[model samples]
Target: MPENILVIGGGPAGLHAANELAELGVSVSLVERDAFIGGNPKKFKYKFLFPDLQPAENVIGELIKKAESNKNIRIYYSSEVTDFKENGKKFDVTIKSPKGTETKTFNSVIVATGFEHFDPATDSKYSYQLFDDVIDIKDLEKMMGEGNFNRPSNGKPPRNVAIILCVGSRDRHVGNQYCSRVCCTVSVKQAIELKEHFPEMEVYIFYMDIRTYGFYEDLYWKAMEEHDVQIVKGRVAEITSGPDNTVICKGEDTLLRGPFEIPFDMVVLASGMEGGPQSPEMSKKLGIELDEHGFLKPANITLSPFKSNKDGIFLAGACTGPKAIVDAIVEGGAAAMNAYIYAKKNAQ
Candidate 1:
């Protein structure tokens, strides 16, 4: 029988790992909690300009189709790995599906479970729970899909919108010392989309720093020059609701070194991303080590990108760390290559 390789989470990392393993004649099984395979990338509707702006749906759709046709690969959608028993050389994995629970044995396991959105309620001063007009960036994206960008409290398009970035990310007080890697670019992209929708609407982005590394610098420039999105270097202190249903953002402009109050019809918290809430539980079950921020600890960055400290177990995608779509895909491919080599060397 071909060696069994189990890949958890049907995101880019898991799928890529499965694909590479199958190419080397290893039997691969992929499990995902969601019915779809794209993970967070599937949630996006717009195109990214840096690495060829293509609808996320199109890119993920093609990958899904390719995986489905692979003979040595099997996919279980809407399924999750509930338990794992490491037996020194192999793993006994118990998976739960909607129909029933099933257990299987595998020679190697790959944990590719992705990250989750940061909760805005972390900052009580933001008044996210108290105010109905305050929405997080992901919520705003979902609302955009509904064909309306109007404030929930009022049925009118926001004249002035304020977006706060680095919330729960890069904040030592929040205990999330690591940068989310994608929030800055995601916020800029969303800001551009909003400008496209409402050309004259005033949009302000409150950010500690604008990280537009690599080719993404072009997109950041486009957002500022073409879209006319106002970029403010400040850390937001609080958000409150006004009597007129407007949202008041209070923050000090770090560059100007002065306190400023900005009133907006709507407020968007460009919340950070972190490891999935269930990651701790999953790591404990699988005997994998988690980093300080609760993300899976990579074996090494310089030599190995997708390897974990435990032998025969690898990690990929946001589970290892926060990354954009392209970066995640590349990491997925790298994980696959590592898994393939491991299986080949240990072949019976």
Candidate 2:
């Protein structure tokens, strides 16, 4: 029999890995916890992506298409690996889905469990759910996807807006101590979009640091020089309702060393990412290492980030950490190649 592989989490990483393996003439079993295949990007209805304002459908939609059309691939939607056991060099996995329980044996497994957005609700200081006008970057992305750019409260165009960076990330108070990796670039991209949609409105980004690393730095420059988006160095301490139906941001300007409470028509929090409950759950079920930040810990972070602690398992995508969609897709390809090599070696 030909070598077979199993891919978990049908996000961009998982989808791409499955497609790559199937193309190599390997029988692939792909499992996703969600009912659909496009993962969080599809579920969140993101209209556009960063670095180049490309339509999200162009990226995730194509991944879904290729995965579904692959003849050597079998997809189990709204399903999970109910049981996993190492049977010699192979692994026995039980998948429970709407279609019912089915078990299979595979030579290798790839975990791409992805990540969950840090909910702004947990931190009451943002006043997220308390005020409809106080939203997060993801919320704004969904709003733009629906062609709704107006204020969420009054349904009117905002005269001025504030995009707050590092909402739930890089803050000891929120218990997330690391940079979320993508929030900075995503915030700048959204800032540019908001300004382009409403040219007359003023847009400001409040950040302790603007970390648009690598090529993404070009987007930060474009937002400032081309779109005239302003960046302020500071962290917002509190958010409260203001007079004239506006939101107030009380923050310290680290550069100038001053405290100021600015009012705006709308506030967008660039919240960070979290590994969510699934990461730990997978760690327990699949017998892999999970990091303190809740992401799946790789066997060797520097050398073998794609390899899991276990012999027959591999890691990919945001499941390992916060990453851009492009990064996740690229990691997916890398993980697939590694998995293929291992499976092929053991096929004898």
Candidate 3:
């Protein structure tokens, strides 16, 4: 019998893992909670990826195509793992889909369930959803994907825009003390896009600290030096209604040590990432550990991030923590190799 491996996600990591395992001659079962397979990037309709700013379709679309064409792979759309149990070296898994629930035993399992975008409304300060012009990063991505650059409140171009960083992450008051790593780079990327789209529109990024890290700094530098995007050293504390259907960003300018309230045509909040409810659900079903930050804990974060604490189960992508798309893809391939080795050795 062939080594049957179960990959619980259809996102970048899971898709890449399934494709690799299929090429390795393993029977791959991919399960996704949503009807489609591309995960958040697909769900949010991301136009371009960060760092190099390549088209999202070029990366996510290729991964989906590769997995769908592979004969060794089977996909379960709009489905989830309802039950998981250990049966000696192999495991028995029950999948629930629209068609019906089916039980299958697999030699190894890989969990790549991704993260959720942090909702700015939960904080009550950013006034997300309360104002038509105030939106988050994901919302802007979707709008940009559809080639709609007009303000949500009115069908007119924004004169000046304020992009607020650190909406939900890195705030102890909001209960998440960790920084969502990609938000900084993503904000910078979107700022560049806005400048390119509307050169005359003033774009200001209100940030406590600009963290573009490593090679991503190139994009940040280009946003300012090349595009004339302004950087404000401050964090917006309150968002209130402004005159002429605009929104006011009220906060202290840390650099100048003075409080200022500025009105803008639109406000874009740089919301962070969260583990979502799936982390605890997967932990309970798979009997793995959850980290302090509410992500899936690996057997060894530094040595074997792809390996779970359980012998026959593995982990990949943002399920482990907040990660960039490229990092998630690499983790998916790594997890696939580890899972294949375990399945080959312990195959029944």
Candidate 4:
């Protein structure tokens, strides 16, 4: 009999895992909470991550096509795993969908729920909800996708835009100490996109340190030399709205050791990434362990990138930790291999 496997969360991680296992002749079922298969990557219009500025829709569309064409793969959208129980050598899983709740048996499972943006409402200085013009990087991406770049208060293009990096990350006060690896790149990407759209607009990024390691470092240099984006080495202290629908950004210049305020037509908080909202519930259901930072703890970092504490469970992508798209895909494939080996061993 073909080994039965369940891959949860239908993002790049889940999808890639399922595809890889299915290629090895394993019966794989992928469940996603959203109506669509692609996760956050589907939410963007275009991803400008250096070398190539490709449309996210196209990338996800291709992945979805490949998954659909695979014979050993089964996909369920608008479905969520509600319960998980170990019975003998198999896992009895319960999933809730629009139709109803259903139970299935699987030899192994892979959790790839991905991550969510950190909420900025905790910081009163950022004024996330109070100021209509103040928005997070994800929100700004959505707005740009909808062709709504102008401020809500006035239907005019922003003359000056400010991006504050590390809003909810690497800050002990807010309880999130781990550095979200992608914020710096995402900020630079958005800044370049903004410049491409509005050549005359002034774009400034306030950051403590620019982390563009590996090939991404070249992109940072491009943004600085070619795009001419203003990089400020400081942490933003507060953002105040002015009468003219402008925003006042106050932060101390670490290099100059002085305080300064720059009035901008719009302000964007480059929020950090965290585990999904349903992560806690899912972790509890599966009896999987989470680290102090709330991300899934892999069984062993050196030997296994996807194996979890549970015998038949695995993890991949942002659920394990922050990773780039290519890294997520690689981890997803590794998770699938782990699940395949478990299923084969149990079948024997």
TM-score for each prediction? 0.92, 0.98, 0.99, 0.95
Question: Ten residues in a row with the worst lDDT in model 2?
Answer: 167-176
RMSD (Cα, Å) for all candidates, in order, is 2.1, 0.9, 0.8, 1.7
lDDT agreement of model 3 with the native: 0.94
User: For residues 165-250, could you state the per-residue lDDT of candidate 1 as single tens digits?
Assistant: 88778988877998887777777777877888899999899988887778777778888999889989998898866657787899
Give the RMSD in angstroms, all C-alphas superposed, for model 2. 0.9
- Candidate 3 differs from the real structure by a C-alpha RMSD in angstroms, to one decimal, of 0.8
Q: Write the per-residue lDDT of candidate 2 for residues 103-166, one digit (tens) a residue.
A: 8999999999999999999998898999989999889999999989999998999999999999
lDDT of 4 by residue, 1-348 (tens): 899999998777888888888888889888898888877877554353343666665666777777889999988889988888998778999988888888999999999989888889986779998887788888878777676777765868899899999989999888889899888887888888888888888889999988877888777787888889999999999888665678899989999999998888888899988885667766798998888888888888778868888899999888987777767878899889888888888875
Give the per-residue lDDT of model 3 (tens digit) for 217-319. 9989999999999999999999999989999999999989999899999999999999889999999999999998889999999999999899989999999
Worst 10 residues of 4 by lDDT: 43-52
Between candidates 1 and 2, the TM-score winner: 2
Misplaced by over 4 Å in model 3 are: none
Name the regions of candidate 2 deviating beyond 4 angstroms.
none
Q: Judging by TM-score, tell me the better candidate of 1 and 4.
A: 4
